[model samples]
Target chain A: MLNHIWLALIVIGILTAAGRDIHEVSQNSYGNGIPWMLQIESPQTISVYGEAVETSLRVPRRQLQLHFHETAAADAVIPARVNLTHAREGVAVLDVTGDVPQQFKIMAEALGSGETLTARLRHRGSGWEAEFDPVSLVYLKKVTNAAFDIAGVAVQIAIGLIGIMALWLGVMKVAEKAGLITSLARIVRPITVRLFPDVPADHPAVGSMIMNISANMLGLGNAATPFGLKAMEELDELNTKKGVATDSMVTFLALNTSCITLIPATAIAVRAAAGSSDPAIIIGTSFLASLTATIFAVTISKLLARVKMFRWDRSEAE
Target chain B: MEIFRTFVSLLSAIAIPALILFFLVYAAFRRVKVYEVAVEGAKEGFDIAVRIIPYLVLMLVSIAIFRASGAMDVFIAIVRPLTDLVGIPAEVLPMAIMRPLSGSGSLGIMTETMQAYGTDSFIGVLVSTLFGSTETTFYVLAVYFGAVGIRNTRHALPTGLLADFIAFLAAVFFVGVLL
Candidate 1:
């Protein structure tokens, strides 16, 4: 089943390696031409509050188009340099008069000095109206060391061959026996039990967690897709409320997302391939971040889950 | 003192592994005792590592291809509309963009994102940090489900996908509103 996918991956690998010159495969993908959407996110709705608030729409020179009058000024859309002064602390609106998109949306948020907001305008009958908040464009401040990027890319390519090499070289049987696969299963199992104690092993969450970890251990994050989803559904069963997400489910998601990625053999090896001075700089960060996020996310989710709305809902008819 | 200690610790972690290899090789030569156990252990590790090497290699190669082909641009573009609908900022698309790719690819992207923006930039840090913490859901699911011989992942896919989605949103929310 994954043969097809793996095959495609192989072709992609060959082509990517071959075409590395043509592709601007950055260690990071965000380019300056596009404006970075700077904003805050809230589950509940955010009201605009005051009328005609002065919000600065920051667009990356790539995405932002400039114009002197009504005539088209630049060949490319980009974050145009603008001259403006701010008043006080509250939301301030700035006059944006230039070549804008016919109909588009810019995701936005408040920023200091250069308050950022996304600007979305529908090319209506008359003129453009704001579809979404004004968005600002921010460029990449940190560039992964080009050499580091090369190393990172190289590691990725090497991993692509790990399975093939393993099968060809012949340690797969030992792997099967050693329960190396259980490392992942062990990590995900108790989490499954904690989340769905009542659910059976064959149930979606328990089974998927097992399967998901198995795939993950095999270095197949893609393969783990179905299992993760099944796990979620089994978890969702505990959420009896509607329109609101449950705390346990949310926490479960956080813990999983913030999963402490123990033993980054894959990454360290990648760094080794790329020829990094410190292949393990990632070891600490990965460990620290994953653990912190797991704890923080789980705690928050658990706290919020204590609210009554997160409980399992029963049918009115029943 | 603390900073110096951290640097020392970090150096030891890096060098210790290499030092062990040297010691093992030395031990293998002296009494040949270390070699006996190590050879057995390594034989096992090497075989297992090699067996999984193909899987690792396949994933790495494909990600390389995705990077090389500019498919990432198209892929990111295709998903851009979906993200906008969901309220994820377009700038932060790199994290979402790299989500489907290998960890290194995403991490590199995350690193750049942090540099482009400030580390204090909520989304920037959240995303970069999140990329490190989170596993690629579909990738993990496919390999594991396939390995176990449980083809009918009908229930499993939804559960994991939901987990991924929720995680994505939570990261965005935590960064967006709280941070």
Candidate 2:
């Protein structure tokens, strides 16, 4: 019974992690549906063989087996392996083996036409024992291009960004006025007191600016920018002199940038969009990338502010 | 406008009690430290995060539904040629760039893309790999800047966006060469 509790906790922890890894939902596994085949046709064929005429090659369905459909006298029919060549050169899109044998090659009848699987068969009683056609042996060369897929992902993400932005903007206004519009906040901060309450109301502009940044940091960037800019105009009232960017502005920017995320929800969304098996990788990458970017940005901006260069830009505009 | 105004008014009314309730929970939990108090205050903010989860899940499901429903596949079929012209897959195209903008939405599209094409296929692998490595620079920059109150996406955005372009080009070229 020694260390019973500790051992039990360790076992519990292991089980939790395993469950997290291969997250099975009620929906579906990776490839659940591939239609059964009836007939297959080779689009093109080239014979380096000195002989000819045989039965169609035997190729399996799930396992893609290759059997010789060659002539009985030529002895060309059998299970064998072969190399497949693509029509294009410098295009690294083939999964053919280096030195193929009989088993790798399947009968032509195995892969029915109107389907997507096809293989080139070759049997060499010589050196490399691999199949090679002057032209490509199969019809496999990126059925879908890469660039277009990325763009499609980008568009969907854009829509999500917009939706989040709009929602966040609405929420910010609600969170802010939650006290001002009601008698409850008055009970808390004293309703008999004034709306100005000493934090220095610089127009609803500055307050809205702060809220804007807060919302974006909350991952509502689509809706935050305009509100933030307007807040600067609000904060302008506080800078009655030559009109310069204040420490609060820089500090606010720094915090927003460095706002440690609660959930890497957005990156997860991207990973899902990208069709990754493990979309959770976004959690780690997002933390590291966002943290580094935010720290470098906020720190440098603050340091730059100490010098005249930082303040001069805004003041000069004033 | 009336609905908006009423909602705002309602939230204002509720916020005071919410703050108090949060404070009471902190006290009850024996967390009177300033840091804990501050964190407990953030727990109120944390509640908003939790509320957003249903949307995230729904969005992902709908994306799956879209692909399963064949709308996304058809969309990709139309997009494939155009994307092919630029060296991308129609299915992978929307998600590659958009994912950086919003993770949840991109995930939905990603589900669709993977369903249409073999996820292990060269382009699928490349897009998935790149999606992990790349940053949604604009969204991150915008949010971070806003959270802390930086106003100029004017310069920061350009640099970040340019970096994004470079990353995109590099991913395409690398996959073309290697995979």
lDDT of 2 by residue, B29-82 (tens): 543443433343343333333333333333333233332222333345666886
Assess candidate 2 and give its lDDT: 0.40
Best by TM-score: 1
Give the worst 10-residue stretch by lDDT in candidate 1 chain A: A138-147
Error of 2 at A25 (Å): 55
Error of 2 at A92 (Å): 33
Quickly count the clashes in candidate 1: 102
- List ranges where model 2 is wrong by over 4 Å: A1-214, A217-233, A236-259, A307-309, A313-315, B1-179
What lDDT would each prediction earn against the true structure? 0.43, 0.40
Badly placed stretches (over 4 Å) of model 1 are A1-258, A261-318, B1-39, B136-162
Candidate 2 lDDT, A138-257, residue by residue in tens: 111111222234345544544454444444333433433333212322333431123223224334544554455444544544445534533443444454342233554444444443
Q: TM-score each candidate.
A: 0.38, 0.31
